[model samples]
Target: MTAPAARSLVLDAQALSLLLRNDRQMITRIEAARRTGVPVLVSALTIVEAVYGKTDTARLHWVLSRLQVQEVTPADSITAVRLLHDAGDLHGHKYAIDALVAAMALRSPPPVLVLTSDRDDWRKLCGDRMQVKDV
Candidate 1:
Protein backbone atom coordinates (compact mmCIF):
# COMPACT_ATOMS: atom_id res chain seq x y z
CA MET A 1 0.00 0.00 0.00
CA THR A 2 1.07 3.53 -0.61
CA ALA A 3 2.35 5.41 2.42
CA PRO A 4 0.08 8.02 3.89
CA ALA A 5 0.68 11.55 2.76
CA ALA A 6 2.83 13.69 5.04
CA ARG A 7 1.04 15.67 7.70
CA SER A 8 1.83 19.33 8.27
CA LEU A 9 4.30 20.00 11.09
CA VAL A 10 3.30 22.50 13.75
CA LEU A 11 5.78 23.85 16.28
CA ASP A 12 5.00 25.01 19.79
CA ALA A 13 7.26 27.26 21.87
CA GLN A 14 9.52 24.52 23.11
CA ALA A 15 9.98 23.02 19.70
CA LEU A 16 10.53 26.47 18.22
CA SER A 17 13.20 27.13 20.82
CA LEU A 18 14.92 23.90 19.93
CA LEU A 19 14.89 24.84 16.27
CA LEU A 20 16.17 28.30 17.02
CA ARG A 21 19.12 26.80 18.85
CA ASN A 22 19.82 24.47 15.92
CA ASP A 23 19.05 21.33 17.84
CA ARG A 24 19.97 18.41 15.63
CA GLN A 25 16.85 16.31 16.15
CA MET A 26 14.56 19.27 15.65
CA ILE A 27 16.45 20.22 12.50
CA THR A 28 16.12 16.67 11.23
CA ARG A 29 12.39 16.72 11.77
CA ILE A 30 11.98 20.12 10.12
CA GLU A 31 14.21 19.15 7.24
CA ALA A 32 12.28 15.97 6.68
CA ALA A 33 9.06 17.91 6.43
CA ARG A 34 10.70 20.40 4.09
CA ARG A 35 12.03 17.63 1.88
CA THR A 36 8.58 16.09 1.75
CA GLY A 37 7.01 19.45 0.92
CA VAL A 38 4.74 19.39 3.97
CA PRO A 39 4.12 22.79 5.46
CA VAL A 40 5.73 23.59 8.83
CA LEU A 41 3.60 25.94 10.88
CA VAL A 42 4.10 28.03 14.00
CA SER A 43 1.65 30.25 15.84
CA ALA A 44 2.60 33.92 16.09
CA LEU A 45 2.31 33.64 19.85
CA THR A 46 4.77 30.78 19.87
CA ILE A 47 7.43 33.16 18.57
CA VAL A 48 6.74 35.44 21.48
CA GLU A 49 7.03 32.54 23.85
CA ALA A 50 10.21 31.21 22.25
CA VAL A 51 12.00 34.49 21.85
CA TYR A 52 13.26 36.65 24.69
CA GLY A 53 15.92 39.21 25.61
CA LYS A 54 18.57 36.48 25.51
CA THR A 55 17.42 35.10 22.18
CA ASP A 56 19.81 35.41 19.25
CA THR A 57 18.11 37.69 16.78
CA ALA A 58 19.96 36.32 13.75
CA ARG A 59 19.25 32.72 14.67
CA LEU A 60 15.64 33.50 15.47
CA HIS A 61 15.18 35.12 12.10
CA TRP A 62 16.90 32.20 10.38
CA VAL A 63 14.71 29.63 12.14
CA LEU A 64 11.53 31.54 11.44
CA SER A 65 12.46 31.97 7.82
CA ARG A 66 11.78 28.30 7.14
CA LEU A 67 8.39 27.96 8.78
CA GLN A 68 4.96 29.42 8.19
CA VAL A 69 4.00 31.81 10.97
CA GLN A 70 0.25 31.70 11.46
CA GLU A 71 -1.41 34.80 12.80
CA VAL A 72 -3.65 34.41 15.82
CA THR A 73 -6.93 35.97 14.82
CA PRO A 74 -9.80 36.91 17.11
CA ALA A 75 -11.47 33.67 16.12
CA ASP A 76 -8.35 31.75 17.05
CA SER A 77 -8.33 33.39 20.46
CA ILE A 78 -11.97 32.39 20.94
CA THR A 79 -11.12 28.86 19.96
CA ALA A 80 -8.25 28.87 22.47
CA VAL A 81 -10.69 29.86 25.19
CA ARG A 82 -12.96 26.99 24.24
CA LEU A 83 -10.04 24.56 24.22
CA LEU A 84 -8.95 25.71 27.67
CA HIS A 85 -12.51 25.34 28.90
CA ASP A 86 -12.85 21.89 27.37
CA ALA A 87 -9.56 20.80 28.95
CA GLY A 88 -11.34 20.76 32.30
CA ASP A 89 -8.50 21.61 34.68
CA LEU A 90 -6.03 23.24 32.24
CA HIS A 91 -6.37 26.89 33.07
CA GLY A 92 -5.57 29.84 30.86
CA HIS A 93 -2.52 31.27 32.64
CA LYS A 94 -0.54 28.03 32.39
CA TYR A 95 -1.93 26.63 29.18
CA ALA A 96 -2.78 29.57 26.98
CA ILE A 97 0.10 29.00 24.54
CA ASP A 98 -0.74 25.34 24.22
CA ALA A 99 -4.40 26.15 23.68
CA LEU A 100 -3.47 28.68 21.03
CA VAL A 101 -1.26 26.10 19.29
CA ALA A 102 -4.08 23.60 19.42
CA ALA A 103 -6.53 26.11 18.02
CA MET A 104 -4.15 26.92 15.16
CA ALA A 105 -3.61 23.24 14.50
CA LEU A 106 -7.34 22.64 14.32
CA ARG A 107 -7.72 25.33 11.69
CA SER A 108 -5.04 23.74 9.54
CA PRO A 109 -5.79 20.73 7.36
CA PRO A 110 -6.48 17.44 9.08
CA PRO A 111 -3.72 15.03 10.10
CA VAL A 112 -1.64 17.82 11.59
CA LEU A 113 1.33 16.92 13.80
CA VAL A 114 2.53 19.23 16.54
CA LEU A 115 6.03 19.11 17.96
CA THR A 116 6.05 20.10 21.58
CA SER A 117 7.82 19.30 24.83
CA ASP A 118 4.51 19.57 26.64
CA ARG A 119 3.11 16.42 25.14
CA ASP A 120 0.45 15.76 27.77
CA ASP A 121 -0.92 19.29 27.54
CA TRP A 122 -0.89 19.17 23.77
CA ARG A 123 -2.60 15.77 23.75
CA LYS A 124 -5.27 17.07 26.09
CA LEU A 125 -5.74 20.16 23.99
CA CYS A 126 -5.63 18.57 20.55
CA GLY A 127 -7.46 15.32 21.37
CA ASP A 128 -7.58 13.15 18.24
CA ARG A 129 -7.84 16.00 15.79
CA MET A 130 -4.04 16.30 15.50
CA GLN A 131 -0.96 14.32 16.43
CA VAL A 132 1.36 15.49 19.20
CA LYS A 133 5.01 14.48 19.08
CA ASP A 134 7.34 15.32 21.95
CA VAL A 135 10.33 17.40 21.00
Candidate 2:
Protein backbone atom coordinates (compact mmCIF):
# COMPACT_ATOMS: atom_id res chain seq x y z
CA MET A 1 0.00 0.00 0.00
CA THR A 2 1.13 3.52 -0.64
CA ALA A 3 2.02 5.79 2.23
CA PRO A 4 -0.41 8.53 3.21
CA ALA A 5 0.27 12.00 1.89
CA ALA A 6 1.17 14.75 4.35
CA ARG A 7 -0.64 18.07 4.49
CA SER A 8 -0.52 21.16 6.70
CA LEU A 9 -3.42 23.58 7.07
CA VAL A 10 -4.15 26.69 9.12
CA LEU A 11 -7.62 27.31 10.51
CA ASP A 12 -8.81 30.69 11.75
CA ALA A 13 -11.63 31.41 14.23
CA GLN A 14 -14.27 31.98 11.58
CA ALA A 15 -13.43 28.72 9.94
CA LEU A 16 -13.64 27.01 13.32
CA SER A 17 -17.07 28.45 13.93
CA LEU A 18 -18.16 27.30 10.52
CA LEU A 19 -16.87 23.86 11.30
CA LEU A 20 -18.79 23.82 14.57
CA ARG A 21 -21.97 24.85 12.87
CA ASN A 22 -21.77 22.25 10.08
CA ASP A 23 -21.37 24.76 7.33
CA ARG A 24 -21.06 23.18 3.90
CA GLN A 25 -17.92 24.99 2.84
CA MET A 26 -16.20 24.19 6.08
CA ILE A 27 -17.22 20.56 5.82
CA THR A 28 -15.91 20.34 2.29
CA ARG A 29 -12.52 21.66 3.26
CA ILE A 30 -12.32 19.31 6.21
CA GLU A 31 -13.19 16.38 3.97
CA ALA A 32 -10.62 17.44 1.46
CA ALA A 33 -7.98 17.75 4.14
CA ARG A 34 -8.88 14.37 5.51
CA ARG A 35 -8.70 12.85 2.05
CA THR A 36 -5.28 14.40 1.53
CA GLY A 37 -4.13 13.49 5.03
CA VAL A 38 -3.06 17.05 5.62
CA PRO A 39 -2.58 18.08 9.20
CA VAL A 40 -4.87 20.90 10.35
CA LEU A 41 -3.56 23.43 12.81
CA VAL A 42 -5.79 25.42 15.11
CA SER A 43 -4.09 28.55 16.40
CA ALA A 44 -4.11 29.43 20.08
CA LEU A 45 -5.86 32.57 19.00
CA THR A 46 -8.77 30.38 17.91
CA ILE A 47 -8.81 29.00 21.43
CA VAL A 48 -9.24 32.52 22.72
CA GLU A 49 -12.27 32.94 20.50
CA ALA A 50 -13.61 29.52 21.37
CA VAL A 51 -13.40 30.41 25.05
CA TYR A 52 -16.74 32.09 24.47
CA GLY A 53 -18.26 28.58 24.85
CA LYS A 54 -19.52 28.53 21.31
CA THR A 55 -17.42 25.45 20.70
CA ASP A 56 -18.23 22.10 22.16
CA THR A 57 -15.22 20.39 23.73
CA ALA A 58 -16.21 17.10 22.13
CA ARG A 59 -16.48 18.58 18.66
CA LEU A 60 -13.28 20.52 19.19
CA HIS A 61 -11.57 17.25 19.94
CA TRP A 62 -13.01 15.80 16.76
CA VAL A 63 -11.66 18.70 14.78
CA LEU A 64 -8.28 18.38 16.41
CA SER A 65 -8.18 14.69 15.71
CA ARG A 66 -8.55 15.31 11.98
CA LEU A 67 -5.00 16.57 11.99
CA GLN A 68 -2.14 17.77 14.16
CA VAL A 69 -2.63 20.77 16.41
CA GLN A 70 0.48 22.87 16.40
CA GLU A 71 0.63 25.26 19.28
CA VAL A 72 1.37 28.90 18.53
CA THR A 73 4.79 29.72 19.99
CA PRO A 74 6.83 32.82 20.78
CA ALA A 75 8.45 32.69 17.37
CA ASP A 76 4.96 32.74 15.88
CA SER A 77 4.23 35.60 18.25
CA ILE A 78 7.28 37.51 17.04
CA THR A 79 6.32 37.13 13.41
CA ALA A 80 2.82 38.36 14.14
CA VAL A 81 4.17 41.33 16.02
CA ARG A 82 6.43 42.22 13.14
CA LEU A 83 3.73 41.85 10.52
CA LEU A 84 1.27 43.92 12.49
CA HIS A 85 3.88 46.68 12.77
CA ASP A 86 4.90 46.39 9.14
CA ALA A 87 2.77 49.36 8.19
CA GLY A 88 4.72 49.68 4.97
CA ASP A 89 3.29 46.58 3.34
CA LEU A 90 0.50 44.90 5.31
CA HIS A 91 -1.75 47.97 5.21
CA GLY A 92 -4.86 48.21 7.40
CA HIS A 93 -6.01 44.61 7.83
CA LYS A 94 -2.85 42.91 9.04
CA TYR A 95 -4.00 42.04 12.49
CA ALA A 96 -1.95 40.22 15.17
CA ILE A 97 -3.64 36.82 14.98
CA ASP A 98 -3.45 36.66 11.18
CA ALA A 99 0.25 37.36 11.39
CA LEU A 100 0.79 34.59 13.89
CA VAL A 101 -1.12 32.12 11.76
CA ALA A 102 0.69 33.20 8.63
CA ALA A 103 4.01 33.04 10.42
CA MET A 104 3.24 29.61 11.75
CA ALA A 105 2.25 28.36 8.30
CA LEU A 106 5.38 29.87 6.78
CA ARG A 107 7.59 28.28 9.40
CA SER A 108 6.01 24.89 9.08
CA PRO A 109 7.54 22.42 6.68
CA PRO A 110 7.24 23.80 3.19
CA PRO A 111 4.02 23.02 1.28
CA VAL A 112 1.71 23.92 4.14
CA LEU A 113 -1.46 25.75 3.08
CA VAL A 114 -4.13 27.78 4.77
CA LEU A 115 -7.82 26.96 4.37
CA THR A 116 -9.61 30.15 5.21
CA SER A 117 -12.82 32.01 4.48
CA ASP A 118 -11.14 35.42 4.74
CA ARG A 119 -9.29 35.58 1.48
CA ASP A 120 -8.67 39.29 1.40
CA ASP A 121 -6.47 39.29 4.46
CA TRP A 122 -4.60 36.19 3.36
CA ARG A 123 -4.25 37.58 -0.11
CA LYS A 124 -2.99 40.93 1.13
CA LEU A 125 -0.01 39.51 2.99
CA CYS A 126 0.62 36.12 1.37
CA GLY A 127 -0.21 36.87 -2.22
CA ASP A 128 1.32 34.09 -4.32
CA ARG A 129 3.90 33.25 -1.69
CA MET A 130 1.59 31.04 0.33
CA GLN A 131 -0.47 28.03 -0.65
CA VAL A 132 -3.94 29.32 0.11
CA LYS A 133 -7.38 27.98 -0.71
CA ASP A 134 -9.78 30.65 0.35
CA VAL A 135 -13.56 30.76 0.46
Candidate 3:
Protein backbone atom coordinates (compact mmCIF):
# COMPACT_ATOMS: atom_id res chain seq x y z
CA MET A 1 0.00 0.00 0.00
CA THR A 2 1.11 3.58 -0.57
CA ALA A 3 2.26 5.57 2.43
CA PRO A 4 -0.44 7.52 4.15
CA ALA A 5 -0.54 11.16 3.14
CA ALA A 6 -0.97 13.99 5.61
CA ARG A 7 -3.36 16.72 4.48
CA SER A 8 -2.98 18.95 7.49
CA LEU A 9 -0.63 19.24 10.48
CA VAL A 10 -1.81 20.45 13.84
CA LEU A 11 0.71 21.35 16.54
CA ASP A 12 -0.26 21.16 20.19
CA ALA A 13 1.39 23.19 22.93
CA GLN A 14 4.39 20.93 23.35
CA ALA A 15 5.08 20.72 19.66
CA LEU A 16 4.52 24.43 19.28
CA SER A 17 7.03 25.05 22.05
CA LEU A 18 9.60 22.98 20.23
CA LEU A 19 8.90 24.82 17.02
CA LEU A 20 9.21 28.15 18.75
CA ARG A 21 12.55 27.08 20.18
CA ASN A 22 13.72 26.39 16.63
CA ASP A 23 14.38 22.75 17.34
CA ARG A 24 16.09 21.24 14.33
CA GLN A 25 13.93 18.17 14.08
CA MET A 26 10.70 20.07 14.44
CA ILE A 27 11.84 22.60 11.86
CA THR A 28 12.69 19.83 9.43
CA ARG A 29 9.34 18.15 9.87
CA ILE A 30 7.50 21.45 9.40
CA GLU A 31 9.54 22.32 6.32
CA ALA A 32 8.86 18.95 4.79
CA ALA A 33 5.17 19.26 5.45
CA ARG A 34 5.13 22.74 3.92
CA ARG A 35 7.07 21.58 0.91
CA THR A 36 4.35 19.05 0.24
CA GLY A 37 1.63 21.71 0.65
CA VAL A 38 0.32 20.39 3.95
CA PRO A 39 -1.13 23.22 6.00
CA VAL A 40 0.67 23.51 9.32
CA LEU A 41 -1.91 24.68 11.83
CA VAL A 42 -1.88 26.06 15.33
CA SER A 43 -5.14 26.65 17.16
CA ALA A 44 -5.62 30.26 18.28
CA LEU A 45 -6.01 28.88 21.78
CA THR A 46 -2.67 27.16 21.55
CA ILE A 47 -1.09 30.63 21.54
CA VAL A 48 -2.40 31.09 25.05
CA GLU A 49 -0.96 27.76 26.14
CA ALA A 50 2.41 27.98 24.39
CA VAL A 51 3.33 31.65 24.58
CA TYR A 52 4.22 33.46 27.78
CA GLY A 53 5.90 36.55 29.17
CA LYS A 54 9.36 34.98 28.96
CA THR A 55 8.89 33.92 25.35
CA ASP A 56 10.92 35.66 22.62
CA THR A 57 8.57 38.01 20.82
CA ALA A 58 10.62 38.20 17.64
CA ARG A 59 10.91 34.46 17.35
CA LEU A 60 7.28 33.95 18.18
CA HIS A 61 6.18 36.34 15.46
CA TRP A 62 8.63 34.83 12.97
CA VAL A 63 7.47 31.27 13.60
CA LEU A 64 3.81 32.16 13.67
CA SER A 65 4.27 33.88 10.35
CA ARG A 66 5.11 30.53 8.78
CA LEU A 67 2.13 28.61 10.16
CA GLN A 68 -1.60 28.94 9.96
CA VAL A 69 -3.21 30.26 13.10
CA GLN A 70 -6.72 28.83 13.12
CA GLU A 71 -9.26 31.01 14.84
CA VAL A 72 -11.82 29.48 17.19
CA THR A 73 -15.33 30.12 16.01
CA PRO A 74 -18.44 30.12 18.16
CA ALA A 75 -19.56 26.87 16.57
CA ASP A 76 -16.13 25.39 17.24
CA SER A 77 -16.46 26.28 20.90
CA ILE A 78 -19.78 24.43 21.00
CA THR A 79 -18.21 21.45 19.32
CA ALA A 80 -15.39 21.50 21.82
CA VAL A 81 -17.89 21.21 24.65
CA ARG A 82 -19.54 18.27 22.96
CA LEU A 83 -16.16 16.61 22.47
CA LEU A 84 -15.41 17.03 26.16
CA HIS A 85 -18.81 15.70 27.17
CA ASP A 86 -18.51 12.83 24.75
CA ALA A 87 -15.15 11.94 26.24
CA GLY A 88 -16.90 10.77 29.40
CA ASP A 89 -17.72 14.21 30.77
CA LEU A 90 -14.08 15.26 30.67
CA HIS A 91 -14.83 18.88 31.37
CA GLY A 92 -13.00 21.47 33.42
CA HIS A 93 -10.07 23.74 32.55
CA LYS A 94 -7.58 20.94 31.92
CA TYR A 95 -9.49 19.41 29.02
CA ALA A 96 -10.98 22.57 27.58
CA ILE A 97 -8.06 23.64 25.36
CA ASP A 98 -7.43 20.13 24.13
CA ALA A 99 -11.05 19.77 23.18
CA LEU A 100 -10.77 22.98 21.19
CA VAL A 101 -7.69 21.72 19.43
CA ALA A 102 -9.42 18.43 18.65
CA ALA A 103 -12.46 20.23 17.43
CA MET A 104 -10.35 22.27 15.03
CA ALA A 105 -8.55 19.17 13.85
CA LEU A 106 -11.78 17.32 13.31
CA ARG A 107 -13.05 20.05 11.01
CA SER A 108 -9.84 20.15 8.99
CA PRO A 109 -9.13 17.98 5.97
CA PRO A 110 -8.78 14.24 6.51
CA PRO A 111 -5.55 12.53 7.54
CA VAL A 112 -4.92 15.33 9.99
CA LEU A 113 -1.87 14.69 12.13
CA VAL A 114 -1.53 16.34 15.51
CA LEU A 115 1.93 16.63 17.01
CA THR A 116 1.42 16.44 20.73
CA SER A 117 2.98 15.11 23.88
CA ASP A 118 -0.41 14.13 25.28
CA ARG A 119 -0.92 11.24 22.92
CA ASP A 120 -3.60 9.42 24.93
CA ASP A 121 -5.49 12.61 25.66
CA TRP A 122 -5.54 13.56 21.98
CA ARG A 123 -6.56 10.05 20.99
CA LYS A 124 -9.42 10.23 23.43
CA LEU A 125 -10.46 13.65 22.21
CA CYS A 126 -10.06 13.07 18.48
CA GLY A 127 -11.23 9.45 18.36
CA ASP A 128 -10.86 8.06 14.82
CA ARG A 129 -11.23 11.42 13.20
CA MET A 130 -7.53 12.39 13.34
CA GLN A 131 -4.08 11.00 14.01
CA VAL A 132 -2.04 11.90 17.07
CA LYS A 133 1.73 11.79 16.70
CA ASP A 134 3.79 12.40 19.81
CA VAL A 135 6.11 15.40 19.74
Q: Say which candidate scores most in lDDT.
A: 3
Query: Cα miss at 39, model 3 (Å)?
Result: 0.5
Candidate 1 lDDT tens digits, 1-135:
743554788998989998888899999999999998899999999999988798899988888888899999889889999988888867856798778778889899867888888888887876767777788
Q: What are the runs in model 1 whose C-alpha is more than 4 Å off?
A: 1-5
Candidate 2, residues 14-121, lDDT tens digits: the string is: 777778777897888878887776767777677575445566788777766765666888888777667656534453343656777787777776566777766777
What lDDT would each prediction earn against the true structure? 0.85, 0.69, 0.90
Worst 10 residues of 3 by lDDT: 123-132
- Point out where model 2 deviates above 4 Å: 1-6, 87-94
lDDT tens readout by residue for model 3, 13-57: 999999988899999999999999999999999988998788899
Q: Return the lDDT, model 1, position 127.
A: 78
Q: How far does residue 104 in candidate 1 sit from its true spot (Å)?
A: 0.6
**Residue 28: error of model 3 in Å?**
0.9
> Arrange candidates by lDDT, highest first: which order?
3, 1, 2
Cα error, residue 117 of model 3, in Å, equals: 0.7
